[model samples]
Target chain A: MTMALAGWLSREAAVIAVPVISLAFGCLVGYLAQRSGFCSIGGFRDFFLFRHTRLLKGYAALVIGAFAAFLVFWLATPAAFEHFPWALTSGLSPVPGAPAGLEAAAYIVLAVIGGIGVGIIGVLLGGCPLRQLTMTSEGNLKALFFVIGMAIGSVIFSALVQGWVVSVMKGIAW
Target chain B: MNKEPEERTSARALAKTPVFVGALVGILAAAVQGLLASAGGPEAYGFCVACHTRDLVNSAVNALAGTSLTVAPISKNAVLPFLTIVGVLIGALAAARVNGEFRVKKGSLTSYAWYAAGGVLFMVFALLMGGCPYRVALRVGYIDIVAVIGLAGIVAGIIAGTKIAVACVERGE
Candidate 1:
């Protein structure tokens, strides 16, 4: 079912506003993230190694804040969040960002594999994607390379890895 | 004696902390939902690094190369691709410049190669899981069971990564 949000702008205006609003929002996020030196992967690594809560608190607050905001917005605009509390509504099915048309078990497998890879890579690289982006702006050439890799990776995934992974998972039926 | 004043000062400084910044990001993401949901669906998609990067890169590529690569519906339906990453680079650059934190740091060619490789692997895995760490938080907030599982996997991976990091350090390579 397609969602229809009681958005602030009409469809025509919203389409026009998409890039503009996203850019502005990105700026705000980038600015604050730079100031705070925020990194989700670093948070986990620090907490695991040193029992530090400083960065961990940031990550935790993000989850809590998103939950609070989503709840409030969903209540105010039901159509916007037709699947509010996704666990109750969608069950084991994931949000739509991953490969589509997989069973719950396959999704779980993909999530685990993907999550582990992300964590390992992020920790090894010293930050998450947001942190990498900010570091690139800070004139870190290594981070720049990482961001460049991501740009290249995007095309590669859509063109190659995505199809291969989906087919494999479907073939295995796991 | 002076403890109360010190505590108060630190409390005031909390506004500048990562915790506060994270909270702001979370709320603004929801605000994006309220403001732009009419643009398209994909519920908890108000903010994401990996996915949005994919959207921006693929859209630009599609337009330029005339290839029918995929992008998020919001980006596809919009007049242009989502420019969050561009904004991030520009915004962070501005912030760093203003704060006097922008400095050119170089690394060895070998390290650069590793990092570049890491980036490719990272993006691919993040997309496989469907989002980055930030989007995982949002999905968890939105109460997706799979995301919760993904979070667990991240924790497990962190533990494993920490071990590898420690091992590498001890080896002095």
Candidate 2:
């Protein structure tokens, strides 16, 4: 599966390009997010609680926009999207972020577990991670703590939780 | 003159709406993949708050302490870890400062502690699902069924969280 990017950089050059590209894109998204108060979890919460569509529209648009953009890019550069329509090609297998060696059922369970955790925490905290990040920048001390916790959590996750979760799953024959 | 000014202000406000921001994020996510897939991929390797944070921290730890902490292959092969989260911090800070919204709001110690704990737990669960809400959107856009399931789980979680929050409020805690 030979993949090619439409970027001007070659594979060797891409190594250096990664951080630069990612950083620039991140800044743009961050700025927009702060200005817009975008929050995915909040979107769902509002709709469910108050029948408000203002924020919900944003979340729905994100999904639709992503699909439209991916389709366009896939058309323009088919090589870049080896599995353009992931469901058709990969079927039940995921996009490779969970602990590997697990079956589809295990991955589904992880997804549900992770998603529920994220959603509940996000709602209780008043926003999603992006919103917390932006609020931290806006001088919200609570949001700042959340960001700090995430940093600490990341290390702990890599060093401990990841192994523990994988082992536990294996133990359960998942 | 007043009417014209109000109309112009409304136009500006439209640009600041979340719908616009969400669309921008989606398009840019695709752009990231289109431009950077050559570097390496797990595909849908686009915008994700949780995974990117994980990449940044783990990679930094690996460098500073010589620990072999795991990170995404894209971040691992790159000359530097993905700096998206750092960029987000800087960008949001800049936006806040420019808009005169950067106030130093303080919180109680206990509140801070809870937030910090929440952050840790959120990161763990988000990673367990593979990415944050944003990444789930991107993955679903890419037509990943697991992400769809994750989305369903998020909805279920939200319902439960809302119920819990309401209960807490009713108890006057």
Candidate 3:
């Protein structure tokens, strides 16, 4: 349905409007998340370290809210069903003609490895990315540095490592 | 003469009101966001952390090239999220003012460096997976099973990470 709306709207409007909505959505989520103390990393950390579940409750609420909303949207809109066309494929699938399934698996493996690294770093850094953003919005200068680092790293990845990154990602599962 | 009890009562009342207001604000903000997204605003995401992170990336890339790059179509839909961030700042500030919890705190150099490293790791993983943990949860809510798998991986990683952090702290690192 979102795609359909994108098609219905002029290309310019769709391009402009979609991001506006996306940003708005992010800001709101960040705000609510900060206010509610919803940090998944913190949740796990607190639970494992201190056997506290207060933070975990926030994470649970977020998941529940998201699931309920998703269900209602899926049921209400036929177009939403169309969005999950690739829901059942195993391993990783390429952009059709790019590589074998193994290559896609490689990407997932890299992602997982990277995910682990992110988790460790999040623990050391005092928050996950979402938490960092929320903390930054709440005027924590420390989180601002993390956000800056993310932007810099992403640019560096795109500029220098795009092909290597894609290839390694492709090669692993294959 | 009898100001102590009165002050304590006022403080308790003040604390209770903001908690109530914050909860209402949060739920209302979330519901509004869901409604907008449900009205065909986006796919598997009415709110996306990864996409905004990507937007920041895209913006940086464009700035580097000495050309003003346009915001992507997907990113334009981030209204409530942005406002929410602003609202969060206001809320935090207000709470701090009322409760006197505001203070300037700094971390050690090691902690700062670790934060930078963590930021890089988060960016790389987020780009690869096409979302962050929040987005992963949102994806699951949308019944995207891939996101569910990713969330599982995240949990596993978090557990391992917690163990490592505990070890490091114990070792005085």
Query: TM per model?
Result: 0.94, 0.94, 0.72
- What does DockQ give for each predicted structure? 0.73, 0.73, 0.25
Write candidate 3's Cα lDDT for B84-147 as tens digits: 3333345545544445545555667776676676677677676565566665655555455556
Candidate 2 has an fnat equal to 0.79
TM-score of 2: 0.94
- CAPRI band for model 3: acceptable
Worst 10-residue lDDT window for candidate 3 chain A reads: A91-100
In model 2, which runs have C-alpha deviations exceeding 4 angstroms? A1-8, B1-11
Name the regions of candidate 1 deviating beyond 4 angstroms.
Answer: A1-6, B1-15
lDDT by residue for model 2 (B1-173), tens: 35788897885586589898888789888888887777777788789999899999988888899998779887888898788998888888988998898999999999999999999999999988899999999999999999999999999999999999999999996
DockQ, 0 to 1 scale, candidate 3: 0.25
Model 1 TM: 0.94
| Cα lDDT, model 1, residue A13 | 87
- Score candidate 3 by TM-score against the native: 0.72
* Residue B141 lDDT, candidate 3, scale 0-100: 55
lDDT of 1: 0.89
Off by over 4 Å in 3: A1-16, A19-27, A84-104, A171-173, B1-42, B63-73, B76-102, B108-110
Candidate 3, residue B139: how far the Cα is off, in Å: 1.8
- Docking model 1 quality class: medium
> Best lDDT goes to which candidate?
1
